[model samples]
Target: MNIYRHEMRMSLRSMLYWTTGMLVGLLFFMMMFAAVSEEASVINLIVSQFPSEVVRALGLSTLDLSTVLGYYGYVFMFILLVASVYALKIGISALSEEIRAKTADFLLSKPVSRNVIVTAKALSVITLLALQSAIYSLGAFIIVDIITGQPYDKTVFLLINLSIFLVGLFFAGLGLLLSVSIKKIKSVLPVALGIVFGFAILQMLNQSLADPVLAYLTPFAYFDIARIINARAYESAYVISDAVLIVSFTLLTYIIYRRKDIPSV
Candidate 1:
């Protein structure tokens, strides 16, 4: 309990500045939606502003933002990707920063074991993620409603947001695991970006490959917003698989971090 509290304090303190910045940045994108809502052809107006390639790259083609699911999905993805930037910033530093700052020596000198330390840090990261996602999603929802004069199904909104939140935690685990394994922060960002983009690209490839089976290979491909929104149900397979994979990876990270030796700079 003490370890968890300490880690939470440290993480919140370290992330206070970054979280504010992300919220402000996200507000810019939300404003775009608010502006377009006034137009009769709201969807087309929003789509027309972006280049075809830009739209395709961002997965906008797969979404139709006029419907609640589509709009929520579109808005959700925008906010998620922007918020991920902050997550990666923190995740890359979770372990490496401690080592680099020479704080690990002092921290590890404590009575708590490595597993406890890692667990606490992991929990702290997850908490911050949940807080950020809720703020952004809820804010977006209210803004959408205010501008459009229509309310979304509260149940569906929460369900979809929860799914997105789970996916964020999965990546958080991945980030923390990487932080423990890799000492250098410089390379972590590129690798993380690569992993994210790679998943997205693979999802796009599934379209031309015409391989429904291959769709399961990419996390981004699963839990699609359009399908979920139209059907008004969660994708059980995606939720299950994502949970399993993230939990497995987190466990693997804890084991490795416990046994690994910290190197001196």
Candidate 2:
């Protein structure tokens, strides 16, 4: 409990920064929706001129930019990217920071077991992410209501927003696994950004190539916004994949962390 509290306190500023950035970005996108709604057809025409592959890669091929939900879907790509980065950073740095700062010796010297320490840090990251997702959802609802002045499908809206959280979880687990698996990490940001963008680029390839196999390579491809909006639910296969990924990586992280050697300070 003490470790959890300390981790949360250390992470509070970062949590606020990410939440504020997401909220501000969502508000800015929603504000633009009004103008875009008016000129949707014109914008669509302009978009149509772009290559079909490019349109699909950008997640604009099948979506209608005229509607609030459609605009939200497009803006969601950016939101997901940012959210994934946050999750990955949290996961990568959760334990690595102790080692990087040469505080692992101090932390391990305590009476608590390493398992407890890892659990507490992991919980702190998950709690912070859940809070951010909840706040972002509320802000999205309020912004959409104000901008569109029409009630969107609540079910679809929730599912769409929920994907952000789920993707964050998957990446968080992956990040944790990597943090423990690696021998030494001098800097986490570069590695985290590389992994996040690498997966993102894979997703773009999946979109452009329309390959089923590539979808399995990236968590971002798991939740298709178009399918969610149309079917009003997430695809079962991807949901199961997400569950498996999170569980597998989390277990692996615990296993490795429990036995892994910590360098003497």
Candidate 3:
């Protein structure tokens, strides 16, 4: 419980910053929906000039900018990217911070078992992730309603936004494994950014190639907005993949963290 509270206190401020940024950015972008939807043809024409490969890579080939959902889907990628970074940072820093701060020895000296410590820290991060997602979802709902002032597919809109949290789970789980598996993480932000972007790039390439096998490798491809909009649902295969990956990452984290040495200052 102490560990959970400590982790939450440490991360709460940064979570607010990221959540605020996403909400404010979403508001400002949605405010332009009217203009964008009006002139979507010109924008589409300019975009069409690009090669189909490039268009597909950007996920622009499928989404129609004239519609509210399509425009929201396009911009939602930015939110996913930013939120995943914060998630990865939280996951990677959770267990590793004790080592980075040279307090691992002190923490280990407590009466609590290693498994209990891991549970507390993991729960804290999960709580923060849920809280952040719920807050952004509410803010996004209000922003879309006020900015568009027209009825849209509320279900699809929600699924698109829900991707932020689902994809975040993948990143957070990977981060936990990385935190325990790696001997040292010199700086959390750079490590988080690099890993998140690397997977993001892989996702873009997978889309460009239109490869089914490659899609399973990256979490970004799992809750693809274009695919979601077209099918009107999340793919069961990807959802299962996400669940399996998260469980695997978490289990590995527990095993490695328990056996690994914690050096003293």
Candidate 4:
């Protein structure tokens, strides 16, 4: 319990910063929807002139930007990217910090076993993420309501926002697995950004290529906002894929973290 509280306290500031940034950015984007809606015809005409491949790669192909939901869908892509980064940073740093700070010896010298340590840290990360998701979702809901001043489909909005949480979880799992497997992570930000952006780039390529196989390779492609908006629910296949990724990586993290030797300080 001490470990869990410590870990959460350590990450609390970071979580707050990310939450504030996302909230402000989302609200600002939502506010712009009105201006965009006022000039929808002109904006659509300009967007139509862009290459179809470019539009698709941007995740704007199937969306109608005039509606609040459609604008939210487009903005959701950026939100997911930022949220993934936040999750990746938390996961990568959770275990690696002890090693990086040369404090693993101190931590391991305690009465608790390594498994307990890991469990506590993992729980802390999960708690932080849950808080972030809930706050962001609530803020988005309120902002959208204020901006649109019309009733939108609550079911669809919830599903679309849920993708942010799921994607964050996937990246968090990936980060944990990588942190355990790698010998050292000199700096968390560069590696996390590289991995997140690399996969994001692959997603863009997959869209450009229209390749079903490539789509499976990137978590960013796992939740299609267009499909979610259209179906009013997440696609079953991708949801299953997300589950698989999260479960597989989480198990692997525990296995490797438990068995791996901590370097002597």
- What does candidate 2's lDDT look like per residue over 1-265, in tens digits? 9999999999989988997898899888888887898999999899899999998888888788887778889898889889999999999999889999998998898999978988999899899889888988998888888878976788999999988889999999998999999999888878878999999999888999999988988999999888889999888998999999999998999899999899876
Tens-place lDDT digits, model 4, residues 1-265 = 9999999888899898998899899988888888987888898888789998998887767788888888888898888889999999999999999999998999989999878987898889889888989888998999899888977789999888877788988988899999999998899998988999999999999888889989889998888878888888777887898899899998899889889999887
Query: Candidate 2, clashing residue pairs?
Result: none
Q: lDDT order of candidates, best first?
A: 3, 2, 4, 1
lDDT of 2 at 164: 82
Give the alpha carbon lDDT tens digit for every residue of 1-265 in model 1: 7867876777775456654565565456555654554452766767779976666656667666555455556766655554555676566666677787878888888898988887777777788887766765676566556655666777667766665467677677777777777656665567777776666677667644547688777666566766766678767777788788778878988888988888765
Q: Give per-model TM-scores.
A: 0.80, 0.96, 0.97, 0.96
Instruction: Report the C-alpha displacement of residue 191, candidate 2, in angstroms.
Output: 2.1
Off by over 4 Å in 1: 13-27, 30-62, 187-191, 207-210
Candidate 3's TM-score reads 0.97
lDDT of 3: 0.90
Clashing pairs in 3: none
State each model's CA lDDT, in order: 0.68, 0.89, 0.90, 0.88
Q: List all candidate RMSDs to the true structure.
A: 3.7, 1.2, 1.1, 1.2
Pairwise lDDT winner, candidates 2 and 4 = 2
Which scores greater on TM-score, model 3 or model 4?
3
What value of lDDT does candidate 2 attain over all alpha carbons? 0.89
Candidate 3 ranges with C-alpha deviation above 4 Å: none
In candidate 4, position 199 carries an lDDT of 91
Error of 3 at 20 (Å): 0.5
**Top TM-score hit:** 3
